[model samples]
Target: MSLLPPNKKKVAKETPRNFVIFGETMNGKTYFTEEFPNPINLNTDGNAEMIETPSINISHQRDSKGTITKSVSDVLSDVIDELQGTKHGFETIVLDTIDDIITLFEQEICEGEGVKSIGDIGWGKGHAMLEMMVRVLIMRLKELSMKKKVNILYISRSIDIEENDVSKQVPSLKKKWMNIVNGNSDYTILCRKIGKQYIRKVESKRKNYTRDKIDDEQIASLLDTVIGAYEKSKKTDVKDAKKIVEQQEKQEELEQKAKRKEREEEAAGESTKDNPDPKQDKQPEQAPKEVTKEPEQSKKQPTARRRPPRQARS
Candidate 1:
């Protein structure tokens, strides 16, 4: 009836932490992963350089000229190799924006089925293909994360979902990629600006045990905490990466100071060949130290005895 079959095989629940973010443009999504090593940014549809995160531009790997140059299957394989063979020392993976990925999918469908566009296609075949592509990507990303101990982050623009109470359809981005993103992610956040305040709310879901189980409030506040990371694990808040690097440099500075002090002390204590000892030079003219003693007591015994004897004779 449509383009392709739904990937019913369960998505592997392997990655430690998967974060999905939805916010307005320039709300610091990319900045959140800056601390990660050079992440492979699957930047399909957005201006990536603006984020200032340490990421590589690989949007062109599959996307170019308004369509995908490589088949989706081939593209997936290539991404796996790139993740395993990265030189950037990255511990995280990111989708800078998924809005553009849908565009790429539409183009890929047109290219594969020989149509000019999704709307021009005979039926909803393009939508089917788009769904399968999203499912495959999510599953693959989860597998890679588990195998490599890498984290995954997906950044997106915000949408509001109103509850009708009777029949509620949540406000969200265009459905093709949006639904898949929503369904797959363990931590989905909605970021909005209400006046001057920045608010982040957890997008609640009742995913079964097949996926990671987390409550709405927990998910939202968890996202709020700078990803509670351990130093040994290199799990760090995306914002704290720059600070960590600075601290490393400071430690190096202290080590250098200690070495400098040790070198100065050694030089000062060393005997030099330039001069003779002061004690040797002054030996001839040196005066001996003077010593003084008190005189002995005088004897008065003889006069006393003569006076006593004369008195006795008288």
Candidate 2:
């Protein structure tokens, strides 16, 4: 009764991807994001002047007295609202350098708790609050991907980590926040500078990065390839499903024919038993007797009657 193809795993429909693109400073992390379709950058690092892509400056709000009114988190919420409420026609939304955004969030947390630094908060609650705030932001971006079909790209700088004397690069965020970002994102690509050429690490294998040459024009080709594979898998599933259905139909037809033949044979046997052929059931005929000529005797036989009753009366 299943709707999926026989012996084939079900594949989900293609949707926009959320990416965490991280690399060292000036390694083209922000520049590569512009290759996505119809992209707009949420410029938080004050580097919007360097990029030609459309961007919105995300900054804290202040009053005339220089007292802080709105936090960066609040401004991000407003941006999400505008994207959801209005038809912005933007296909991709980039958070330019999420490292700066995290820093702003930490500052906002410190200001709210009246502390000089995040560590001053009692019982390590400040870190927990910051993590929650970042998680909320990621969830909101996911909503945009779901409801509006928008792709989200978070840009960050990579920090090197040493483990077992092997160095590896990861996003420039705290371990807890980094885990959150990587878990929530569909892709965690690394931009590396190999000599003068820029290459992107699309996948990782046993500390060996799978590199792909990228430029401003073809940075988004990975997404295209993924979507194309999805389409091909879908078509294959449909074809397999149709073939299975046809096979089931043929098997059923054969079964029906067998049943019909069995029924006909039973009917013929019953008819033969009910009415047998008369010629085959008839008894054997005897020879006709010959009539012989005989002499006429003409003598009548006399009968002796009983007269005992009359004698007894006399």
Candidate 3:
């Protein structure tokens, strides 16, 4: 066959792949995975029986005192075997809690060294071994998504921490392994309760979905909504935006009215100084005219006095 150009690669539709769902306990993390198409759960905590569905407890072998018997490599091999099986009949594979899986990796390291704890491998070898195990598992899980075309969901619990004086809810993982878990997934969602309802919040996208509160029945529809929202939806509330705009307009109008009133007052003051009142001018005119009338009265007063004097003499 002739080689095809890389630019002529076939186009394919993107579907949901890997998701990390984490929050407080009993917040529907497991139930959300149940909504997916035919899921096989790897229950490390042995709570799969609480889900009311068929599940496999992959972390089974333990001693009478509850010591882990399965090695990390063994568990990884079993999961990959199921992924390769044509008769496995599972489209989605879920790890109940990635936190516990990390613990199992530590146990595997201790057992290999014939020690009671990973701390026995001193000089930082324990940390190195743990990190290597985590990376190997992360690589294989990614393969399940890309090569095997299977969906993977990792469930974890949330914890609170202060970053730059602001408290935030983040997945409860050790600092050494937290970044790996966070950076490896296609989506990281936060599940929580709001009033009488539960919600799943995607922080980076500023979006939330109503979780199933009444029954597990709504999980189906919620899953569809979440998967449909590959592209982000708007975050700003419309009502809040309209309120902000109205407040700005009202402030502008008030400022204009104050300016207009100041202009009117200034204009009135200037007009009064330029043109004196007519009534004020008339008052001065009447005072001067009364002074002129007094002189005229003096002229008439001599004839009246002459008549009175003649009468008195007679």
Candidate 4:
């Protein structure tokens, strides 16, 4: 591949955002998202009173035939048509509290199976169902974002994820189990409460190999933001991304300095051997040899000119 100049490499365009704004229950996420537009809301939890917006209610997800139904895939397809095909002229599409949506799905599936809860299922089928739901939701979101020129907003409840203890990596609670959710979106904001205010922070620990990595400062800080519209810019999500990169650059510089010092020392030692030092404080024998040669050369040169003229003519 051809190389790009540094300035050219730095230039990038922002993707149409499929943003996830998730945090503690009633953390003003809905309040914040409403500022963008009166969104086409797939109101999963039926909690639109919290925000005043023009929203079409798909509280009971059903076909045009109005069948009493709870198929996420079917309802999502319906949701897709209304957002894109409908003459409503909606700009922003919102899916509020997806965690609750999935739970509704779980209940529906459980009821269909003549079971009471996930505990009713044997051989982990319920867990399997949850995984499938995650996949279906992710795929649907991607399709909607690309085909329709619409920005997506997904709001979810907060929960913790296990860290990779071996690698000292603090696995992102948002990314680990719900990577499908996090990866599909262009931006993700992890909201946390600090007294009366809400802080929105971005998550950067997205890679599978990031196990054992932790962001200690971020953990203590109130705000984080991850703009994942571009894969290359993931590092920018880091709170100290520039500084982290700089630190690595600094470490490399130190190593280069040490290497240069070693080379200089090697060159000096070789010079000493080729042109030996006669400074005799350490080696008296070497000094005496130098002294004898100096006098001999001086004595021979002055007398030798007259003697040579007298003796060597024949």
Choose the strongest candidate by lDDT.
Answer: 2
Q: What is the lDDT of residue 135 in candidate 4?
A: 77
Ranking by TM-score: 2, 3, 4, 1
- Candidates 2 and 4 compared: the better one by lDDT is 2
Give me the runs in candidate 2 sitting further than 4 Å from their true place: 1-11, 14-16, 203-220, 223-314
Worst 10 residues of 1 by lDDT: 225-234
Q: Model 1 segments beyond 4 Å from truth?
A: 1-16, 35-38, 58-76, 85-88, 119-124, 161-172, 194-197, 205-314
Q: Clash pairs of candidate 2?
A: none
Number of clashing pairs per prediction, in order: 2, 0, 0, 9
Q: Please give the distance, in angstroms, between residue 291's alpha carbon in candidate 3 and its true position after superposition.
A: 99
Residue-wise C-alpha lDDT for candidate 4, range 1-314, written one tens digit per residue: 75865554543333434767777766667765665544667776656555477664445556698654666656776777666666767657787766666676676677668788887799999878867877777677677767765667877777654332232222233444457776776556665667987665555423322212322232212122323312343336566887877877886787789899999999999988877864743554443444344433454454445545456666
Model 1, position 114: C-alpha lDDT score: 85
Off by over 4 Å in 3: 1-5, 8-12, 63-69, 204-314
Give lDDT for model 1.
Answer: 0.60
All candidates in order of lDDT, best leading: 2, 3, 4, 1
Q: Encode model 2's per-residue lDDT on 151-223: one tens digit a residue.
A: 8898888889753357988888776777777777766678887789777765321121122322223333554
lDDT of 3: 0.71
lDDT of 1 by residue, 122-144 (tens): 66877777778778887888777
* CA lDDT scores, all candidates in order: 0.60, 0.76, 0.71, 0.61
